[model samples]
Each structure stands twice: as structure tokens, then as C-alpha cells.
Target: MASSSSNNTHGKNLRNAVVALLAPLPSIFFYLSFLRHYSAAAEAGSLSPLWTWCYHHPLLLANTLFFLNVNVLFWLIGVLQSSHWMIDLYWTMIPLLLIHYFSTHPLAQCNSWRSRLVILLTWVWSIRLTHSYFRREKWQWGAREDWRFSDMHQQYGQKWWWISFFAVYLAQQVFLMGICLPLYVVHSKDKQLNIWDLLASLVCLTGVTIAYFADTQLHNFVTRNERLKKLGQDLVPNLDEGLWQYSRHPNYFGEQLWWWGLVIFAWNLGCGWCFVGALVNSLCLAYVTILVEERMLKQQYRAEAYKNYRKRTSVWIPWFKTSLTGKEKET
Candidate 1:
């Protein structure tokens, strides 16, 4: 039995190593192809007008290439691991990469105070969120997948491989690019910093901090609850203290605030179309994310604790509270 167990462990480790080695190939290949194609087109000067136009707009070209590379890589990884959540790690990282690329690009007008501040805040937010996700996921190559993805695998069976490419990976890629649109606008034009820019910066930072602390509190609660459970103790189904007390989804609220800050920054630049990204992000968070998450929580807990918490706490707004009887109130 011991020898068999050891053999199984070794097999799993070998599979993980292999997957890790091959995971980055798709992105590397796509990036090299993009550079070569771009260089050849520039030298020939016979490329189509559309390709020529894309070359002038570095952000557009970069966004398209980056998205294509990452999306393909994600699908490849998912196919290898049979886990759709593999794409989740890059959700925060992609925006930061795009912002950094454009900010440092020669074509970018990123020397203004507003641009610098926005870049700094974006870095902070991205780093915090990435760190949180890394720790929470306890990610390792060839490890057990997220429960949600596991459920999807069971539901879709064999067809899940291709279905997830579109439903999960590509859909998330679209959302990510949309949310990062403000960075494109910010780098495209040279604009002086204004008071609104400062306000937006503050709001963005505040949202990041709020989300960080809320996640921390929830993590601690879960840790304690698990420890107690191991000791044969029963705890409540949901955490409703600290930041969770004010809002059932405080982290989601903070996320909305952070995205809305981008909207404000773009609006300050006098571009109305930039609002589309934040608007779409808001709808996704409010409708898709929260609804699905709450439903999952209810199904998992089954007890009345989560239901009661939902009734009393604000769904997305922290300040606005709800009553047990389904009445709205200002907290």
C-alpha cells in the first residue's frame, strides 16, 4: 500500500512538472509571431491600411496581441489540467501588464501627474489582489481544481473542454479588456492633472484598501471556523462581523468602487465612450457575480444563517442596509 501510494504521488508530481513546462509555450509563440509579423509589415510598407492604422495605435495592437496570447494560453492550460479556473490568476495581472506597457511605451503621453498617479494606484491594486488570490487559491500545478470548475466539469462532461474556452476563458478576457479601457484612453492623450484626478486616485486607493481588509477578515474567520470544526465544534454558517457586517459582499462593493474610479478618471479626460467598460463591469458584478455567488452560498450552507445575513446586510453597497423583513434602511 505504501509503495502504491508513493507511486501515485510521483505520477502526480511528474504530470504537474510537465504541465508547468508546456504552459507558457503558447503565449511565447504568439508574442514572437506578433513581433515578426509587425516587423515584416513595417519593412514592406505594403501592409493593409487597417494593419498600418493598428501599428500607429500601439495600445490597440498590444491589447489585441496580449489578449490573444493570454486567451490561448488559458485555454491550453485548462485543456491540460481540465480546470477552467486556471484563467483566474491572470484576471488582475493582465490589466497591470497592459497599463505598464502603455505607460512606458514611446507613443504614450504618460508624463502627466494624473497618469502617474493612476498607474501607481493600479499597481497597488493589482499587487494586492494578485497576492490575495494566490494565497486564497493555494495554487500549485496539477492540484485539485476550484469547486465551481469541478461542478462544471461534472455537468458538461466531455464537451466542457471547448465550452469552457468560450464561456469562461474568452468571456473573462473580454471583461478584462473592457475594464482596462481607461488605461488606453489615459495613455492615448496628453492631459493635465485636475482635482477630479486626485479624487479618483483617492477613491481607487480607498477601494483597494477596503477590499483587502474585508478579504483578510473573511480569511481569518474561515481559518478559525475550520480549526474549530476539527475540534468537533460547530460554528455559524456565514461570517457577519467586521466588514462583513455592513455588507454581505463587501469585497464586491470595493471592486465596484475601484472600477468606477476608472470611469471618473476617463470622464475627466472628456471621453464619454470610456464609460462603457465600467458600466459593463458593474452589470457583470451586480448581476452575474453576486447572483451566482449568493446562490452557491445558499446551496452550500442550507441553514438559515446565510439567508438571514443576506436579508440584513446590503448586497453591494456597504452603507445602505437591509432589514430582516426585507425593508431597506440607511445604516
Candidate 2:
């Protein structure tokens, strides 16, 4: 009976994974169809005024497509799954979608090298994040939702059903699209690759490397502690090694660096406004970091150790640890 139950769960997860894989197809089809029709109309000089406007303004079309797919289709999937876990998976994928959308659109007028470089970098970053996500999920698709979402579910009770549309899906649309505005700018602008491009690429790659290692370290720590728990031994209280030793949230910092690094590419292309998305994302991360720390302090076994770790660690940017005073040492 135990074996049977495990098999059932595996079957459900496999089915969910297949559905999640195909969920974005419709939106992608629509966008490509729109582009094809727009191109035909442009050549014949018979384009509708609104279609002409859309051709000139690709970001507007991108966001509208994103809304229909995420806000509508993804929400329905979440309602069916009774869990918003799918969106967490989509978070790593949407940027890859956006980059392709911008690069393939008729209006794409970017330097060939820069466009290809950004797309390649995005693929690398996406792969790393998706792998981290699956590892965090223990390779079980849709088995668990993020802890923060679970907290909100409890906080709002029945009201969460409606509130989740705004709080979860819509909020993600804003942040995801905002941070990805650089993709559009990168494709729209035709500046030649320069020294700044090299610098931006370096920064972006460094961020991905840092985030990859930090997540791996944190995952190993949690896994080891879980093993100890199973053995009825005392679990390690905190992760104060590797990247966590220098910063309370090195992963968040690394993520921000990656986004901001892309913004540098946009800035070099004369689209400084692209920074808005990365900036907003950082601000949201700040709130999330505070919430995470508060939750950590609530843990009986982890609170004392985490409190001391927080005192000596930088909140975001990594640096050498601060020395503890005599009073702090005694405590």
C-alpha cells in the first residue's frame, strides 16, 4: 500500500510536469501569428492604425500576451492544482520566452552580436535557476508551493482565492516584465558592442556563478540537517558557511546583480529607463529578506544562531564579517 501511494504521487507529478511544459504554447502561437499578420499588412501598406501602433510598440504587445497567459491561463492552472507551484517554475522560464519574443519580432533592430550574446546569457541564467528550483523541489513537480505563499494562504483564509489573483499572479507579471524590459531595449536599440558590453557580460556571468554556488551550499546544508533529523540527531541550526557567511542573502544579491548587469547593457544602448525593473525587483527583495529573517528568528533551534549570524553579516553585498564585541561574545 505504501509503494502504491508513492507511485500515485509520482504519476500525478509527471502529468503536471507535462501540462506545465505545454502551458505557454498558446500565448506563443498568438504572438507569432500577430507578427506574421502585421508584417503582411505593413508590406501592403494596409495595416490598421492600432496594428501599426503595436508594431512600433512591441513592449505593449509583449505585456498583453503575458497578461493573458499568466493572469488568465496560469491562474486557472493554479486553481485546478490548488497550488501556485507552477508559477514558481514559470518564473525561471518567462524571461527566456521574453528574450526570444523580442529578438524574433519584426522590429528587432539590435546589433547581431549583442542580441545573440544576451540571448545566450539568458539561457545560461535560466538553466541555472530552473535546476536550482527543481533541486529545491526535490525533483517533485507541483508537490509543494513556496513557503511564503502558504503563509499568505493561511493569513487570508477563504478570501485567498480572489486575493491570490492580484497578490500572486499579477504581482509576478509586474516584477517579471519589469526586470525583463532590458531584453526589449537590447533588441530595439542598434548600438554596436563595446567595452561596456564586455563589462555587462562579465557582471552577469559572475552573478550567475555566485548564485549557483550559494544555492548549492544552502541546499547541501538543508539536506544534511534533514538527514540528521531522520537519524534522531541534533540538526545544524544555521548555514554560516560558504556564501552565507559573508551575506545573509547572497543568492538574492547575486540575482540582483544579474538583473542590474543586464540593465547596464540597456544603459549602454541609450535606454537607461530599463533600470526601473531591476530597481523595483531589488526593493521587493528587500521586503522579502526582512520577512525571511523574521521567520528564521522564530525558529527555536535556529533563532539564536541566526541572530548572531545576522549581526556580523552584510545584508546583501558580500564583505568580510564584522568582529563581535566582548558583550556579543559573552552572549
Candidate 3:
């Protein structure tokens, strides 16, 4: 009876804490995209037009400020996730301090509506994810960096995340401009929507849908199972039902695909190497997902059932399904 009461109390506390964290973070999720002054279309590789024009332009100061502040914001996100305040302070300030070293990069300019639009899109995505991170997780800092962050840190360390913060920002801003480059550079301004545009739109929508459902299902499973356990019921035998069939991580798969959708939109725009950024980014993310996710499952769920599931299902592609007999659908 006492144990059951304690579990109920824990669940209630977690629910309340998550709700408190979520209420304030969703509004600024979309604000970052709207702040940029240039479009992705103006990228000139040798600092010809893209870098020269924006850096000299006084109107783009906000864009510079935005880039600098994003690092700080990411640090704040780290704070909210960390259980300890001191660790939060250390992680948060390190990235923020590193920004000074790279704030003077040539690509840090603002120019067109397309650039602005892409910034808006990225901000919306980032903030949305930050919200999800705080609400979806239970422990504070040091519990585990988000596995994506953790693996990179373990593999690389603070210096890399530092280099990563600025290098990644410059590159993303560059890529953001590239994706929107066609919109800005092309004299025609083909904003009227084409097949690739439609596909990109659909891909993003599909991702949102999958993320929503996957999150819901996982949350329900945890809630229901926790409740059952508290009531002296047995643990669930398997989670091989909904999004668990094709791959263990439906949400991560959707996330990887969704970014590719952005790349496709960039491709249709006639941007050259910019699409390469998206492609490479997607591929790298897939590798991260596979490594970190498997590491986590290995730590938390070293069950025979999971071992069996791992044997047959493909990682990201839904090409195969695993049966209890260890056979997959015939290719």
C-alpha cells in the first residue's frame, strides 16, 4: 500500500512539473525564423555578394544579434534539462562564451525574405523541440545529455560542441540562405509552389503527424504501464504494436525524413551545393540516431524480446517487419 501511494505521488509530481515547463516555451518557437533579414538565395562562395553585402549592411545587425543569442538560448535549454543548477551554469556559459570567437565570421549577414523565412522555419522547429525536450524528459542535467548531444560530447567533448555551436550556426545560416537562395537570387521569384514545394510541404506535415502520434503512444504506454505496476499488475510484455514494428524509433525516423523534405525544397530551388548540406545533415543525423538510440536501449532494455526485435527490423526504412519466429517479410 505504501509503495503504491509513493508511485502515485511521483506520477502526479512529474505531470505537474512537465505542465509547468511547457506553458511558457511554445510561443517563441516560431519567432526565430521571422528575425532574419536576408534570403538563402544570395550565397556567394568567395564573399563576393552573399557575405560582402550583408556584413556591410547595417540593417542586418539584428540577424547578427540573433545568431549570437541562439547559442545562449541553447544553453538555457540545457539548464532546464539539468537537475543540478551548477552544472547548468557551467554548460550554459561555455557555449555562450564560445560564441565570441566565431561571431565575426563572414557569413553572418541578413539580406532577403527567403533567408528570413528559413530562419523562421528553423526557429519554429528548434523552439518546438526545446519544448518537447523539457516536457518529455524526467531528470535534470547529468542524467544524460540528450543522447544526440551525449554521443557527440563523448566522442568529441566540450571543445567540439564549442566549435560546433559557431561552425554549425555559420553553416546552417549559410544553408538556410542556400535553401532560400533560389527564392532570392532568381530574378523570377518562383514562390508560386511547384511539385517539390508540395512534396516538401507534405513531408513536413507527415513528420509533424508522426511525431505527435509517436509521442502520444509512448506517453500513453508509460502512463498506463506505470499505473498498472503501481496497482500490482504485471509489466507489459512488449511494445511491438504501433510505431514499434518497422523500427524501434518511429519519431527519430520521421525527424530524419522531415529534414530531407527541406533539402528537397532546396533542390527544387536550383541551389547547387546547398542541397548537399541537407543531404549530409540528414545522413549524419541518421547515424547519430542509430548509435545513440541503440546505446540507450542496450542500457535500459536488455531483454530477449528487444534482442529479437533488433534482429529483423530495419533501422529507418520500413522495408522489413519482424515476426515472433525471427523471420522478416520476404524482400
Candidate 4:
């Protein structure tokens, strides 16, 4: 029995490793092929005007590639898996890819400390997020889809097969590409590193650190509750300690800060338009937060506790709790 269990675990680990190594290849291949084809077409003067325009505009090219790779390819993969779980995994990876893509493009003009700093910070953010994702997933790939996607599946019924293309995958393309626009600006412009860059770096790093601790705390809380349930003990009603005490969703708050921090970099580079991405992301997160809180309230075991917790806690930003009577509560 022990030997069989050990072999099963080993098999699962090997399969996961293989999938990890291969999962990014398709996107990488598409990116390289895109650049190669663009070069050949440009050199031969065989490209149409629209294609030529895209070649000159790295942001446009990135979005086009994103459309094909994520909107089309990832959507198809999600259909095959009968789950949109893969997109959740890739969310932690896409920014990292975008940062590198912009920095390495033939038209890239960046070769400065700002570029290096942005890339390094992106790496840090990606690694931290990816690690949190895997930890939440118990190091398993695609074990279950996010609950919201599952809800949408049922809500949309048969229409989900098509609606998901736009609602899930395409919407993600818009948000992800938008939030990553700063990466393009960082690489496209050559600007001297300034106080703003220092400030942006600090904000980005702080966001990553806050998100790391918040997620760790939440995960530990959940794991402890699960263990208590198995031991036939009464489960904790709600998590209202640590960062959760100050805000209902510190993880989300941190994530918003990270993206907006990138926007600061672009804004300093004179592309304030990049704020659109961070703004859209914030709106999306606001919607998700509503859904999450609604779900929490529906849980009979902790509904009242969560309602009181909500009364006391700020929705996103960390702050001193409020009294149940809606006045500021001293912590």
C-alpha cells in the first residue's frame, strides 16, 4: 500500500513538472514566429498597410498576439478542459511575458536603469503571485476552476460555450493587456531614472509584500479551519485578524496597488493614458469583491459574523475598523 501511494505521488509530480515545462512553449513559439514573419514581410515589402502599421506599433503587435494566443488559443484550451482554470494560472505569468516581450522587441529603445528596475520588479511581482497561486492550489495544476467561473457556467447555461469566449477569455485579454501597457511604455521610451521611478519601485515592492503576507494569512486560516473540521471541532466563524482586520480584501488592495504603481512609471514617462488599464482592473476587482462578499454572506455558518465583520472593516484599503453602529472603531 505504501509503495503504491509513493509511486502515485511520484507520477503526479512528474506529470506536473512536464506540464509546467511545456505550457509556455506555445505562446513563446507564437511570439517568435510573429516577429520572424513580420521581419520577412517587411523586408520583402509584402505586408499590407495594416500589418505594416502593427509592425511599427509594438503595443498593437502585442495586442494582436494576445488576441491569437490568449483570446483564441486559451479559450479553446478552456473549452477542452471544461474549466477556465488555466487562465487563472496564466494571470500570474502574462505580465512577466509582456515585460520581457516589450524589452526585447526589435523596436525597443530601452537600455536604462528604469527599464532594468521595471523588469526586476515585474519578476518579483510575478514570482510572488505565481507562488501564492500554486500554494493556494496545493501545488496541483487545474484541480478545480474558480468558483466564479463555475457560477457563470451555470448562469449562462448552454450559452456559456460561446459567451465564455467574450465574457471570460476576451475580457481577460482586455484587462491583462491594458494593465501591462506600462511595460510597453517602459521599453518604448528612454527616460532618465528619477524620484518617480524610486517611488514607483517602492510602491510596487510594498504591494507585493503586503499581498504576500495577506495571502499567507488567509491560506493558513483556511487550512486551520479545514483541520479543525476534520477533527470534529467547531470551525472558526470568520477571519478578522491580521490584515483582514483592517480590510476585507487586502490581497486585492495590494494587487491594485501593484498595477497602479506600474501606471505611475508610465505616467512619469508621459503616457498617462496607461492609467486606463489600472483603472479598468480596479473596476473589475470591485465587481469581484462584490461577488465574493455576497458569497460569504450566503454561508449560513458565518453569515452573521461576516456581516458584522463587513460593518467594521473597510472594503479594500487598510484602515481602522468601524463600530457596528457605523462609527469609527478604535482598534
Compared with the true structure, what per-residue lDDT tens digits does model 4 show for residues 1-331? 9999978877866664565557667768866876787788868979766656756887877787778877887788778768877788889988999898888777889647888899999999999999998899888777678898999999999899889999888899889998998999999888788899999999999899899999999999999999999999999989999999999999999998999999999999999999999999999899999999999999899998887898878999999986565342332
Report the error of model 2 at residue 237, Å. 0.8
Model 4 stretches astray by more than 4 angstroms: 1-23, 33-54, 326-331
TM-score of 2: 0.95
Which candidate wins on lDDT?
A: 2
- lDDT of every predicted structure (CA atoms): 0.73, 0.91, 0.49, 0.86
Candidate 1: how many backbone clashes? 0
When 1 and 4 are scored with TM-score, the better candidate is 4
RMSD of each: 4.5, 1.6, 10.0, 3.6
List the pairs of residues colliding in candidate 2.
none
Residues 181-276 of candidate 1 have per-residue lDDT tens digits of 888778876777778888888889889988999988988887887798899887657778888898878888888889888878888887758778
Residue runs of model 2 more than 4 Å from their true location after superposition: 38-54
Per-residue alpha-carbon lDDT of candidate 2 for residues 10-87, written as tens digits (9 for 90 to 100): 898998889898899898887777788887986887887767777787888888888888888888888778798889
Where in model 1 is the C-alpha error above 4 Å? Answer: 1-54, 139-146, 289-302, 320-331
Candidate 3 lDDT by residue in tens digits, 1-331:
9999878767755654564344323322322232232333334224335434544552243245434544444445443543122222222222222222123223443234444444444444454454455455543323334444444555665465455455334444444433333322222233444566667667766775676566667777777878988999876744666876766777676665556666666566665444665566566657766675566466443455566667766666655675555243221
User: How far off is residue 185 in model 4, in Å?
Assistant: 0.6
Candidate numbers sorted by lDDT from highest down:
2, 4, 1, 3
Count of steric clashes across candidates, in order? 0, 0, 16, 0
By TM-score, the best candidate is 2
Candidate 3 shows a clash count of 16
